[model samples]
Target: MTPPATPTSQGRPDKPALTVLYDGACPLCRREIGVYRRLDALAPGATVCYADISDAAVPVPPGATRDHLLARFHVQDRDGVLLSGAQAFLALWRHLPGWRWLALLGRVPGAVWVMERSYRLFLRVRPRLQRWAARLD
Candidate 1:
């Protein structure tokens, strides 16, 4: 089964929408999503579905559990490809303006390796950052 469409502002029918499944409960995640949302809103012809996976009412991805969604960043590209972690972020940046250059750079031979490793390291320290963010809120 496929996910539903993300109706564009112009209502033009196209390929499947690029949807970013995010954890709204996490301050870090929310901040990043907020940036992407703003960028997408300003970019013409860009339509992204921002799903709050932390919401109890939101449906879980086809085969993924809610915990899996919270553990890592996930994105469903227009091709219906599911991407996670650094790749997911890279895919998303490709749709945003200025950031598209960085996304292109990610396709370099060694860039993805480094980016994935960095994402793993960030995951390890995410708990501490979340705590700090919570305190700041």
Candidate 2:
């Protein structure tokens, strides 16, 4: 299904609503991204795109290095704004069918702040989780 022509702040509709940048090499990340991919495929007129940042062939966004992007969860919005951490997840959840409620919850005052803090904690242990997931592969 074709995405609706939603205008960005600059009045452009050429860009997809989101472009998710992910580390394909990380088993944990790959599995999570797989879930999103399946959901996106099932959603009619889904406007989210995925970019495997681990792949050398994928072009990194301007002013961002591949390593920096791979180090965190990131999504580029329709206006080409790059969001990281919980903000990125919130943006993605808003688009996914079953996940929109969580996005709404995130909109509550201080909810995103808490989520971002928790995400920062997760980042600290992500390498260990990645190693464990790789072992299961």
Candidate 3:
């Protein structure tokens, strides 16, 4: 069984539950991340780190290139396991408060598989969405 989450003196977790790699330059991505960040602020027990892969200063995981990270959603869990697409989103959702239900759904048999497929479809149109979102900025 997992132990209860505890915050460090700095009010951050001793080890982050997940580190999210995102394309900070993308307006759509920023809006989504902003919602997650606000939810994270409301629930402090679990620590979620957000890294802007679009920023050269942010570090990329070993075996992953900057372009690869920027192209998709990715997250590193507490155990150092790297997950992308639906898996990454699930890991992140499990850390948040209200979003935990969505993460729980991911545990259902084949749910992740279906979600992954949907995410892949989204990737095909992501560039178009990004362009549209950028225009709104």
Candidate 4:
């Protein structure tokens, strides 16, 4: 992952930047991450780094692989807590400027369940989505 331009604020280096681990091999995931990259660029200090796990240049944690990341999003917070799937998305939303409300909603009773189910449905159809995206490329 390329280091983003240096943060303008001189803060503690111990503050971990938001690390988003995504599937590089999936076209649909790539398109979504591209949008995130653009948004992060607009909000400079918003992200520490982003990694496409499918990239040979990117390092994966022990026992992790491209297929694992393709199944869901993974986010590692500043304190080194790892969140997956819907929980990961919620964590990310919490960090975004105005989307903190979505994060709160995600934690509401049954919200995580709904998001997880929806994510599963998306995964089920992702192969077809990838093919469709590829045709456009």
lDDT of each: 0.85, 0.88, 0.86, 0.73
Evaluation by TM-score, superior candidate among 2 and 4: 2
Write candidate 4's Cα lDDT for 2-93 as tens digits. 23334346653444466788887877888877876776666645664677777877766555665676578897766566678899888777
**Highest-scoring model, lDDT:** 2
lDDT preference between candidates 1 and 3, better one: 3
lDDT of 1 by residue, 25-106 (tens): 9999999898998889898777677889899888876778889988999998777678998899998888887788989988
TM-score of each: 0.88, 0.88, 0.88, 0.80
Model 3 Cα displacement at 111 (Å)?
1.0
lDDT of 2 by residue, 93-127 (tens): 99998999999989689999999999999999999
TM-score of the candidate numbered 1? 0.88
* True lDDT of residue 98, candidate 1: 78
How much is the lDDT of residue 19 in candidate 2? 89
lDDT of 3 by residue, 33-77 (tens): 999999999994648878888999776777889998888899887
TM-score of 4: 0.80
